[model samples]
Target: MQSIVLLLWLALCAEQDVRERQIANTLTLGVGLCALIFLFVTGHTWIGSDAEEAGWALAFVILLTIPGYMLGQFGAGDVKLLAALALATDRQYLLGTIIGSGVALVLWLLSRRWLWSLLSQKVKNRLKAWGDESSKKQPFAPFLLAGFLLASVWIH
Candidate 1:
């Protein structure tokens, strides 16, 4: 049930990002908070205090976000989504998700660049140098959803 909601949240976040290149802070905060509370209520804590665990998850999300934000690859929402996932999964599943999302992110970036290289020479060169920061219609939520699912399947 939690996983399903997490997947749905990621899907919604992805759709919003693909459509608008932005995600509301309320949504991310709500999910992160809820997950933390749920974990605590369920007596399945991560490490330290819940607040500390949430902070750690947020840090992990920020770490993943740096590259994407630096290369103009993704938005803060993506980072928040990953952060929420990190909180939900906690330390136990963190390793799997990191591996899963990392793999997906690499593949996604490579493919996006490969397609960009097929554009005009000038555009291709520019893309090869700095990459496109343009907003477009691509559903990336599915990839994230897949990553979470795959990690859950393999790790658990």
Candidate 2:
């Protein structure tokens, strides 16, 4: 199950990185629906056996992220992705995932300057076309993937 989630995250990261930073609804919603079905069929979730925990996790993620969504700080796809992940993760580990994402973002921000200098001219030009240095926006799925991996390791 964890491997499947990792593969899904990898797909999302690839899409966000290579494409226009848009996440497909089919992927996000399909993952969420599958998670719900898994919980129903197995009486288990990443958090526990309770289906209510999954519901609360979904609600918590929505409540937590909706403000950012409304403020345009986050795209709809990012919020949906978080919500789907919430349904699949334990509440305790979910907090760790969120914190890990922040840590990953900070690390990337600090390292990107040095890393940028090492990139080939063509790659640099392409990255520049993706976004300017001043913009805070960048593909976030990678950070999410890092966080998910970190939380998985830390908790288990």
TM-score of each model, in listed order: 0.60, 0.81
The residue pairs found clashing in candidate 2 are none
What lDDT does the true structure give each of the candidates?
0.64, 0.72
lDDT of 1: 0.64
Model 2 regions lying over 4 Å from their true place: 1-4, 46-49, 120-131
Instruction: In candidate 1, list every pair of residues with a backbone clash.
Output: none
lDDT, candidate 1, 1-156, per-residue tens: 656676778777765655555667877878778877877676544332355565566677777677987787766666676777777766445556667766886787778767665689865553332344563534445467667777778855
Best by lDDT: 2
Evaluate candidate 2 by giving its C-alpha RMSD to the native, one decimal.
2.7
lDDT of 2: 0.72
